[model samples]
Target: PSRTEGNTRLYTDEDLQRLEFILNLARDLGVNISGIAIILQMRERMEEMQRQIHDFVQYIQEEVLSRATAATDASRGAIVPVRRPMVTPASQNTRKK
Candidate 1:
């Protein structure tokens, strides 16, 4: 609910939708006012958590892409030599009794 210039409460489309949701919870779902409040609070918290997760994912993606680009550019003219370790074969002789 918002206040107007005449000190009257104004309901927007979003407000109406929320009111409808609350009414549905009370009438159809047989939820009490306190239960409805709890449900709404939980819903808001979940939505906030979801938003944070989305932001974190976006940040990680950007960081990864930036690091990859920097690594590619830094290695453009560099020569990295690869070496493999030599392994010796085990002797097949067994101890005699």
Candidate 2:
């Protein structure tokens, strides 16, 4: 927080958004300062993990495609994309029972 000549703290858009988020956690969710701190830390960690997972998946996909292309001969057809099987909600429910 930076102060102006009038001694008023100037808040940026990002700072305002963070303040609003903290207020919501305190007023709406009834989370105290310590709890809010913990929640924010966990959220940051989860976001970091998600980013790492996405990078790893991308790297693996690129490596596999490159290797496949190198291994294929002129007689063999070009690399074919493999489609993953989609699991619908109905299939999930059946498995549960």
TM-scores, each model vs. reference: 0.75, 0.60
Candidate 2 Cα misplacement greater than 4 A, ranges: 1-13, 73-97
| Candidate 1: regions farther than 4 A off | 80-97
**Total clashing pairs in model 1:** 0
Please report, in order, the local distance difference test score of every candidate based on alpha carbons. Answer: 0.95, 0.91
lDDT of 2: 0.91
Judged by lDDT against the true structure, how good is candidate 1? 0.95
- How far residue 2's Cα lies from its native spot in candidate 2, in Å, is 6.9
lDDT of 1 by residue, 1-97 (tens): 9899999999999999999999999999999999999999999999999999999999999999999999999999899898888897656664332
Residues 12-38, model 2: lDDT tens digits: 998898889999999999999999999
